[model samples]
Target: MNQNRVQASEVAPRAGLADISILANASLTSVTGTDMTSNAQGNYDLALKYSGTGLASVGVADKKVLVYALPAELQGKVVGGATVDIDANLLPITPGDIPGVKVLFDALGVTINTLNAVLPIPSVVAAFNQLKTVQNLGAYQKTLPAVVSADGKTISVEFTQELSEYVHQAYVATFGSLRAAIDALQGGNVVTKPLIDGLKLAADKLFDVIELIASGGSDILDLALNGNILGDMNGTLHTTVSDPGAASATVKAGAINNALISADVLTAIEQEGEAVTLNFPTTAVNPIENYDVAAPVITQPVAGQTQVAGQVTLTQPIPDRTTFEAVVTLPDGSTKNVPLAADGTFVVDTGSLVDGQTISAKVVATNGTYTKDSPITTATVTAAPIENPIADYNVATPSVAPLTAGDPEITGQVTLNQPIPLGTTFEAVATLPDGSQLTGTVESDGTFKSAGVDQLAAGQTVTNG
Candidate 1:
């Protein structure tokens, strides 16, 4: 042994294919050898011969083996299974095989036509095509983890920071105008020109626009924008009275004097003290006729009078004697009580008024328990005219002849100291004993005869006519 012993290193280094061990009693018949090649597709074939009839297993039985053409750093690391070649089958790497690599690729592959089938929206398809051209798309894809279902029908994508950032940017770009509009609305910085023009248009066709919106649906916008705002302008719409400081009944009368409302419409509302109630009519028509607040008609104090006669008369009777009083104001500014008669005649004797002095009078009516006053009517007064009397006139007594049975006529003669004027006409009036009156006309000579005396009785007496 010491003479020719071979070292194990030397023998091991020189060992060839023939020196390789095989199962016991199993022998190699022949091997088709090929030249060693550096190409990945290089192959070698071996033939085996066995003398024994028993079967022999090749490689490890009932064991899964994985072979990966990995880099030098990951040579021993557990990777994809050799049972199914990942590259040959085009299967994606899973997190189970590689702790960090989560990939799911469809066997059919994803294409633009496939995405177009899923998303029919043209804008979405265009956006997807644009996304594929982005320079950072690969970086984003690397951060996204996908999972394939066991059934191989679905691919679920897990949320990732890169995906989140991409989604946020997409949302902002898509809704940029909407976000700006909302901000403008919140800040009350809307464009005034367009708003005003739109408002004017709506005002012009308010009913039509309301009808259109109402036909849409029954939501809050329908009710607030159309139903509540566009209905009839009746009831409390045009006229609503509220008293914040006091009770509703304590509001002052005439405080709501809208010119559109007539006095008759408000007459029933008490204008006086507390507890005054307003009773509006169901209809808007004014019920009272000739409703007015005109001055009272004064009928006395005749025009163009030389004397100051303190008398006043109204065409119509006073409404209430208890609440009204007539007064005559003298030129000296003194007032006299002018008692009103039931017939509306009033007399105020400012005894012996001075010549050419003017007199004025007014009737004042008061509201019961309320200090309010009706319109006062002032009477027009004028001075009474001066007069002259005739100095002398003759009076003649006429004698009458008694009526006889045969002579039914009663004759009488009247004498004046002066001759009557040529154009003057005379008349005589007589009173009979029966309290009846008889009339006769005198001739130019002043003598007159009564012919209707035929009805005179015996006890009846006749006087000068």
Candidate 2:
């Protein structure tokens, strides 16, 4: 194979990525093939190598490493009896030989074939610029020059592993710019409230993804850089469109238009040094206006409360168009709904809740446009403490004189085994010989007094138990 010959293909349209209107495609060039003599297995191998000389020329920094190949030419050999495999290698440059190119490969295994297939040089350059400008990575930029290999003569052909950090940093910086732009727009109240909220939420999630990548290290970086994140997000969003046929197309078109409009609004804001309005058309078919609404926040009940019932009064009364319901989940796995009053107060049922059991509650708010559910709040059931009854307590016998002849009153002093409780009361009783009984109150000092009794009743006795 000729080392200097680089093949190219006709430009093709980029589907699903209509927003990126950059260099769509490159022109095609003829592949000057070497003698393809088939081996015993009827397979042919093509190998191409690029030296460091051409890359050492003046204005080499501006030269792109990307190349496009037509699929027809690749299929021509496969259509024949022979199988074809093409391999290319880009040798590294010495760091000392180049002035502007500080490190040839940055020890990052970026080959020319990888640049041509996976990533173009223009995107890498653009991402680097964003990292510098948005994240203030001047120190990081300085460290880029020190990542070269010891000899800088050979590089691994895989680009994803090498450019993972580069792409992740670029994603972070780009997300930051987008967040800042959205903040500016929201602060100015330029976009509709729902749209602003939706964009902010999406940006926040993207930020979380970036943070996750930072913590997960290289494997996550490779996955995200290979478009898994975007692809997953696209699949998730496609499920939410009401009309899958025509509405999907309209929604995508509206999204592209809105993105373009947002960019223009951001530019205007930067130029005028002030807030600016963003105007984008909204129709029934293009439901960008119906973004997600934030969930309501509910207060928790007092700890150890036996019942989970409470009156939830919202700060602002819910609008007539909106409806609110409190979903109460019992320990038995059954659910109950509590409707909200016009005044935005909901009194949930607590009869089903029992002591030591837990019940979960969440609020669901819905309008015709959007529905949201609050985070679940749980409360453990508890009951008021019961006082222990007077059990296993001893009492001394009452001391009373034998019945005298005169009508003398009954009197006695009784002792208790345990200390008297604050609300404890004592009573004295006398059983007469006629099978009747008389009772009296006892003072805190353990002294008792009864009604007058005849002294003639000699067999009568008085006791305190």
Candidate 3:
């Protein structure tokens, strides 16, 4: 087994049903849909709805009802006495053939809902993006082998675990990781501020989920919270240092806030089967006032810069001398020290830049401490913009010819306007007297040809051919 690449069995995704009911802690506070359930008449009937329809969410809004497609090894594996397994390896792979292993859960309708976890308020883009990516991959399919009992009465279902199981393993593993990062970071107030801001952002999103589910959209909530990701980010966190290859440049990024968000409040609601809603005072609390952050700045060669890329540029609100140094690093991994310039400005030379190469730079004080300025890239230094004749092009101005008597197509090419590159294909179309049309390609000599003229009648053409 290759440790670097995940195995096939580990990645097989479990089929899913995407809807769920979010009842109040006990006695469903509200049924989102009309009457909650429909009858044979399809009329609303909460009592009947709960009894029938076999409609339940497996924790995803739009996934198919879960029917684990079994691999060969565990043909008759079962979980908690369910035996819907057919052999796929022995079954026909070609169309119209039943596979050897087929595992189906009996008319088992499930109510899938979100298990709210503390999402650090600050992980909007990165965390959400990761969630989306994981969804595409499908929570590592766990319905791998459906086991049957000796008497063929009881059953068990299990799957080869992957990194994903950790996602659902525990809230501590997920949320705890961020807590550890906050504790481990050294930038005093500077770094913690952004982290708090990120958490607050996540809180707002959680509130949105609460409202969506309470209003009959449990499936949407399921999608947002189903899979576990970024749950392993525990303990030590290294600073991300930006690199400036040749000359230095500066990048500015959003600040992190350290506002504390208690995820327990939200998760508790979810535990009780009640949707969580963020109810803030109407006056609103501005969490970011006086966010303490280190003004750590770095002086490094910019990324993707050439030998002559310009010198380092500092962003506004430069950090104090304590947080930043006055030197930059070149592409060769050598340092270009600054004289601790009074005005927070420094320079790098183009003579040190290399041609046909790219580089970047970042600002840090203690020889690779917390990064201050964002990294910036520069195009390779070159004598001039390289010109490639093959890449250049000219579009000839087109000429329009009015439809003539019984004319079915429009035809005109400007031979004198410009010389089109060789292998260029052009076309013109015409509508005949009848309502028909034609189209075709152009030739090297700038000549116009047409098709579909035959489709038009001599006196019945209406529009462009």
Candidate 3 lDDT (Cα, whole model)? 0.30
The 0-to-1 C-alpha lDDT of every candidate, in the order given, reads 0.32, 0.37, 0.30
Residue-pair clashes per candidate: 7, 2, 94
lDDT of 3 at 79: 23
Residue 136 shift from truth in candidate 1, angstroms: 98
State the lDDT of candidate 2 residue by residue for 1-465, as single tens digits.
Answer: 344343323433333322321112211111223323323222333322211111111111121121111111232222122111112122222221222121322212233223324323343334323433423211111111111112321111212222334444543444454345434533323434444455455445544555665554434434222221110000001000011121111011111112222334323322321111211223323221232323333445444443455444553433334567778887777888988666555565555445677777777766556566766777665555675656534556777655565556777777755765556678888765555667888787878777855554555544433
Which stretches of model 3 miss by more than 4 angstroms?
1-326, 329-397, 400-410, 415-426, 429-437, 443-446, 459-465
Q: Write the per-residue lDDT of candidate 1 for residues 1-465, one digit (tens) a residue.
A: 653465543453432212221112322121221111111111111111111111122111111111111112212221111111111000111111111110111111133234335433244334333322322111112222233223322122222223223322332243233223222321212534444333333323422332332343222221221111111100000111111111111111111112222233233222221121222223222211222223335444544432333223442322221344566666677987644565555655555545455566566544333222235555545445544232244557887765665555667888855655444566777776677666788877888876665566666666665
Error of 1 at 198 (Å): 96
- RMSD vs true structure, all candidates: 45.0, 27.2, 37.0
Please give each candidate's TM-score: 0.20, 0.25, 0.20
Question: If candidate 1 were superposed on the true structure by all CA atoms, what would the RMSD be?
Answer: 45.0
lDDT of 1: 0.32
Sorted on lDDT, best first, the list reads 2, 1, 3
Candidate 1 TM-score, C-alpha based = 0.20
